[model samples]
Target chain A: MAGLTKQEGLSSPVSVSGLSYAYPAARGGNSRLALNHLSFDVSAGEMFGVLGPNGGGKSTLFKILATLLRPGSGRVRLFGQDTQAARGTRKRMGVVFQNPSLDLRLTCEENLLYQGRLYGLSGRDLARRVDDALGLYRLEDRRRDWAGSLSGGLRRRLELAKGLIHDPDLLLLDEPTVGLDPGARKELWDHLGRIRGSRKITILLTTHLMDEAERCDRLMLLHEGRLTAEGTPEVLKGEIGGDVITLETEQPDTLLAGVRERFQAEAARLGEHVRIERKQGHSFIPQLVEAFPGLIRSVHLSKPTLEDVFIHHTGRGFWNEGAQQESRGT
Target chain B: MRAIAALWSRELLRFFRDRARVVGALAPPVVFWFLIGSGLGNAFKMPGAAAGVDFLQYFFSGTLVLIVLFTSVFATISIIEDRREGFLQAVLVAPITRLSIVLGKVLGAATVGLIQGSFFLVLTPLSGIDLPLQGFLWAATAMALASLGLTGLGFCIAWKMDSTQGFHAVMNLFLIPMWMLSGALFPHSTAPGWLRFVMSANPVSYAVSALQHSFGMGSVALASLPLCLLVLTGFSVATLGACVWLARDQD
Candidate 1:
């Protein structure tokens, strides 16, 4: 099957700078900005991950790239063509939305055929392309099955295949694997990894999973519509510059006050534990042990994680949603 | 042409797939053709009306027009489903021209409308209404054009509406009243003056009137000819234009 020629490589990195957006909401008849000067660049052929809490504008940014929602004020270029223009920009990109887009009534093969024909392919050419996509996604066996009848993982894989059916240069995925079992999620990730190796399809995926974010070549941490940090996973962890000292104590508040007073250390609480950032965890342990001897039942020293990196950068967990104070109380 | 064929084929495939949908598309025209035609055929008072003609003969056009109207309006459900399922987005992102996309689906749905409208043509003889070969051809042409017009209107409405409930409500508010006022099931002379004006302005009324004329019924309303033809032509252009405009920004 003939796909887009490699000689037609991506032009340059997608760039967005000084972009601001706001949704009009009636609150005493007032509107608020959802995003403020959100600027970030995605280099071509790189797996770029955007990590953020729920309602933190991650999906909003994805929508902007997908061209589903217009940014109130911003410049968005796809392969250097203005997205708002619609004609030249669409040929370069493929988008798989968060909502399921597959036609459940049609068989998987038929759905792909219909989508391919929309892009001006037909007869033998269309059939060959469909076969290629089906084989690539490992869905050749179940190509005759209805899309709605497939498991969530299979459906998601099909969605990816459908999006790529036109052989687009860029793939924009909005929470593609939002709800899948662990085994299925792992399997889907493997398929994703395989595709990335085979094709230079530039992928920009929005994910809330810390582990998934760590797998990306580069990660952008977005907090409340703002870019807090951008770098490789290791570099992001290195930015924190210290080991994490976690204190598991029954009386965390009392122990925290005493530790602050004696050791002059600040800590962030997570459930029943308090994670403190310190240069030397081993050296600080004895001092902490002596001061809060009985209260500090156990002390664990761990390397900084992507979750920790996000927390350090955004001062919040990746799963945290600001509106639910009661949820955070847990 | 290929895009239109693909879209139209998809609609036909979808229409035949659901048993209930097919039955729903055919039921109204068939039932109304018999009931209203029989009632009016017995009580009609037009002195110079064709002899041996049952009310079903005069009502056949209206019933067929109803089929076109119902099929066109309900086909909007496909749009809602496509939007909900994300299938529409897949089509929108393709490299084909946007007008082909709208034209394809509209023509596809209209094919079903034409088929259902033609079904009533078969029952016309059974309803005691004479069906000549020329009558069938003319009526078929009228139904096809009316279905095309209605499908175009449906496509335009579906483009702007995102929710199924809203789509249904608009269909009910816009189409149901227009169908009732169009002299489809009843004679326009019996309707109130305001309704007569509405029927005069209604494109469906002209469509049904044109179909009725094809069946060798009463004199053609000359004043309505230009008005109906203009609305049909103008709305098709305007709605299609709107569809193309909306299609461009489809991310």
Candidate 2:
């Protein structure tokens, strides 16, 4: 973390240089790489996002960073300490896994108390922290209720409280908003925003949601076990250098060929729509429709988004390959 | 120490809160003991014993061991859920050693098994066996040793498992067979030579022998009480070591 992510005098909370991981084969056959020579650094107090499609190595990266899996190669540093030999570093990382980690049988207060004890937090200090956590998450009223009895949002809030009970410097969440309604997702993000507002704690979360990715201060794109692009959402979208135009036409292949020939513009078919990137997308839309007449169904124009940047770099729609955002449990 | 204690107490607290678990761990053993012991009651007679020691009295020691065996192993089965996706995963990332995990979980199950097995002891008078307070104390000690060893063994198997269905298969095919061969349902003396050799080698057989001594019963093929204890302790330590090893990061 020291040199990889440091700029001037800032300490990187997480820095991975040339990270890779592959699950062992069940039988004697070739195993697929879950992470491939990945390198990145998360600046302190930043809400760093790892945006990727499912099976694009997000969960594997999360596990390696959380010290559940050993790195296949290269180093992962937390506050400039190697995670392989990371007993002390584990104290600094608060990880909320995609899976529910709550003891459903235990009450909310008991869950928090025991989680505090695991981090060696005990006595009056632990009790106060548990109290503070319950209060902060608006779970004070449900303190005596079983975790299983809480609604999905409340259970997630309790999970967040449990993860932060020891007050870690870096909080890692893997697909934190999974299986949540939109209201709950927004509420969870609001709570996270509140947490970040309270202190300059580094937060790194993995998500496939573009809107959620926009909330991050900065993020990287991952596909097929490799880094595709990395930057702030605005900057990544700015990299496309123009507006994006989508043509809904019956003859997408013919339209793509004719657009390339007549306008000499680069166009690619993205599923049901033919996608084109032009400096003046709105003006070009008129010429496109007039030239094609009835062949073109409709034209839509918008500013370049993170998905366009992804398509620009990866030469395929973000959902063209794996549309499902399901995590593979390793 | 605090972490392990918290984890251990959580298991006890969960068990107490769930009345079904308390009843589930206990009821089967009693039903098995009563049905089997009575069905074979008048058909059995010992070669050398106090007068009128029926099959119920003779089978009491093995039945006690069986209670601990089932209770301990069944409790440890939850370790699969913990490893796959649950609270244990959270604790696994904490600044704690693998030994803490093994000790916390194994001892929790062992303690629960001992408590539940003690409830079965109240029915010993039905066996017509003379068990004084000293005898009960000795029996409890033997039960604790049995629980600790068997629970450690359960932890070892469960640490590497990914699903409860696979664990249930192991419980049926491996653990249940282990108890059966430990002279639980039959006498080691009347067994065939090959079966006798297998019973002599089984660690639970030594546990049953220790319990027989605790209950002042006789086994023709009984190992010495001190030797039985030594074996149980060695088995517990070996299993505990294997469990910690399996729980490590690299493995």
Candidate 3:
């Protein structure tokens, strides 16, 4: 319900006010609002994350900020300038899309060089920058090799290098680690952290990964085309005020009734599991198991994650990869 | 302008790098020209009948038109896939204008078509059609003009299409007939009344006529060299204008 629109300076790296977007109707279906009255601001030199389930409007917001889609209502301002006339500000923002945008047939070096030239960077300066990008991403050895020949992890690193070869002030990433191994994802984050450390760059990346969201300086949770919650990960986790208890049971309805009657804690059924939130949730587990006899199958207790934060703000559980194969933004 | 040149160069780089695609696209025309020209040797009387010209000699210009069509048109087909999932989104978000992007891509494909045309031009002796230096230069110029116009036309068709299957469908529905009716297989005098009328409306017919004129067989075509040049230039400008218009979310 709380949204920031008319805050301070419009010159912030990214500022959205009353933003809403509706994809045009299918032949028989009515139009659906992909984003509804969303408002937020990402300050300079901050790593911000938008975490959401698929169809939660992460990509719609991304497209608007990246200047790919024109907003249906409200405004997206990049560095004090409206995105309508994004020509000047577009030079300041570099976007790494969810899709692999590299020309696989072109050499790693040529891909970077061509990206530089698109931004009107050329000659020896562009060449030197390409070299620096190669050295920075450790792609120097693969400079002459075809991009398609590189592994997914190496290709992603090369993609990051290409995105930064122009040295833009703001970097926008959409699901930056969509198809990478855990180690590769960690490597990418390290590189991103290194970029932020060495330069005055503001990064805004969207993801469904809870740990990835935790790495961000500040975060926003989106569900069903609305902003459910927004704050630092720590603060958002603190909103739940204690630990989260997830109990897997064959009959969640009966367990939910008994747990609430016996424990006097916030309890709800999430899919096939009973989730309870209370202070000292770990201690409640032994009592919960003792009361239930042979009813409880499994119990998981942990600090509230971004996923729990999403569930805390919205009763619906987060959609995993199996639940949402492709986002509605597509 | 530099951005446009970079995109243009990238297109050429990708085209040459795909060895299988390059060989696949360039080889068919040679076989078509050789098999058809030899199999149907100088049987039919020349439509204009100036002298002892064989079917191989008459079909040389037609073969040239085929090469230009196949190479350049196929080049623009890459756009549909790029627009759907890949490299083009990066180009769209870049600081460059949409017009420059269209010009860059169309001109790149046009250049590829020109190269293929010139490659075929080198083997004019195999067809036993001896062209002097003046004829060769004129033929090259005509090829360049045809390549530009057709590639622009291809860009126009492929720009808004999301699927290459749809593009191929459009190609089969429209482009193949345009090539067939351009007097590539048979001359104007040989066609029936309605067929000639349709061929008269086809712009590629003008390109074919221009190429025939460049081959020193101007009488084989209905139009003169200057008229063909004017038509080809007009077609190039019109199609390029359409592509730029489509590339723009708004004009």
Candidate 4:
């Protein structure tokens, strides 16, 4: 139908500029600046990832794009229409929140059908679409089961299916893989990849996982409520100044001192391993071995991964530091 | 329209699946009608109508009003649960007007009120008192309008709210005063002059008066049918406006 046509790659998707937001002070404290002049564009049919640590403004940006939260200043346009001014922009978007949004009381099929009807599909149309969604998520077998009884991964899958039941032009998913096990996470990625391939839905999602960000067609990194960097995975890695080399050693400080004296290079020591970024690590290893014999136990040479690029840009490990802080604070 | 239907289905499905909640939703009005209806049954008599109108009939009308009020207020819990569970975000993200959501929920909660209201209708006949089909229909319509008004009110209050406890507290704070002044348990004539003036201004009093009119008591002094329906329409509109305001983009 005509609705199916809009489900194809958006001729023009969402674009924004200079979006800024501040949350009012909770109780008596100072107001928090949640987003600081954030600016980015999601092109048609691209799987765009927002990578950020907790409280890094990833969700705040997602909410702004979803029109759930209005930006205090700046403009957000969906399909070339100002989201705040246009009353109907919302109809073309679908979102899967960080938490499972399924109504636990209803069956999977019932939930989708209800969502479909909410979008104005009913009768035979609703039934067919709901069935398709259930099948798409491989949830047909459990159509009659209560949503609350489903496993975490299954519920997440159901959430995805429901978001797409309306065949929205844009899909905004926030931290969709946060709680899933590795197997389930992979399965969901497969589903997501298939969705982009087949339906051409413009997907904008947030995930702190570097591997997940690498899967996206393009990515934007948010830190302290600002966009730090954005580019394709390949482009981003290429943009990093040099290759990353890690050497495991019994005496990292001794090995690092020798390397620093020999090449005047910066060496970061972490526990028993030392990381050095250089133009050619494999060629330097031989000279290093000769300079400081037997100091190194194992050496690995690889091009910069997204994590390396993140470290090069941010000066700190992304997920590790955030994870440590989260654990410690709790 | 499709959005409204979806929300309505979700609400009914939620109501049916939560057996304890459904039972809880149904229990209050029944108990109130039985206990309070019995005590106040003989306390009311429509002027010029023979003192012959059964006390249960008079109080049953009030019970129906109470059912509308309680069903609408308790439906706020579903909204809070949906938000906490992340379902509200899913709906808001959908490409549908927010008004459809409020309408769907109001209609769905009204369905519950109708069911409970019908229970009262059924009980009257069991007690050997039969209202005409017209009377039953009129009462159902009145109760439904009241339910819609309250559902809209409940949606406005529950929208974007974080906690169920906080919502329940607000619901009680708003609902109790409205119920108390609604003349649901007592006739306005027995209230103090100032209280009567307050009851006249209270929307629920208009609603209860309309409901009592359905019992064939002919005491329409509180609110005429046109006035009651006009206020009902205004209540729905104002509540919907509030919902829209509450749902406005807040990045």
Q: Which structure among the candidates has the greatest DockQ?
A: 2
Q: Rank the candidate models, highest lDDT first.
A: 3, 2, 4, 1
The reply for model 3, stretches above 4 Å from the true place, is: A1-10, A258-264, A282-298, A320-330, B48-52
Candidate 1: pairs in clash: B41-B55
Q: What tens-digit string does per-residue lDDT give for candidate 3 at A183-221?
A: 999999999989988988989999999999999999999
Span of ten consecutive residues with least summed lDDT in model 4 chain B: B42-51
TM-score of each: 0.90, 0.94, 0.92, 0.85
**Ranking 2 against 3 by TM-score, winner:** 2
CAPRI-style docking class of model 1 based on DockQ: medium
Please, what's the RMSD in Å of model 3?
4.3
**For model 2, which pairs clash?**
none
lDDT (C-alpha) at residue A45 in model 4 = 78
Q: State the lDDT of candidate 4 residue by residue for A134-231, as single tens digits.
A: 88899989999998889999999998898888788789889989999999999999998888878767898999888999899999888888888899
Q: DockQ of each model against the real complex?
A: 0.57, 0.75, 0.63, 0.56
What lDDT tens digits, residue by residue, belong to model 1 across residues A147-218? 878989999889888888878778888887888889888988898898888887788889888888988989
- lDDT of each candidate versus the true structure: 0.76, 0.85, 0.86, 0.77
Best by TM-score: 2
Count clashing pairs, candidate 3: 0
Considering summed lDDT, which 10 consecutive residues are worst modelled in model 2 chain A? A321-330
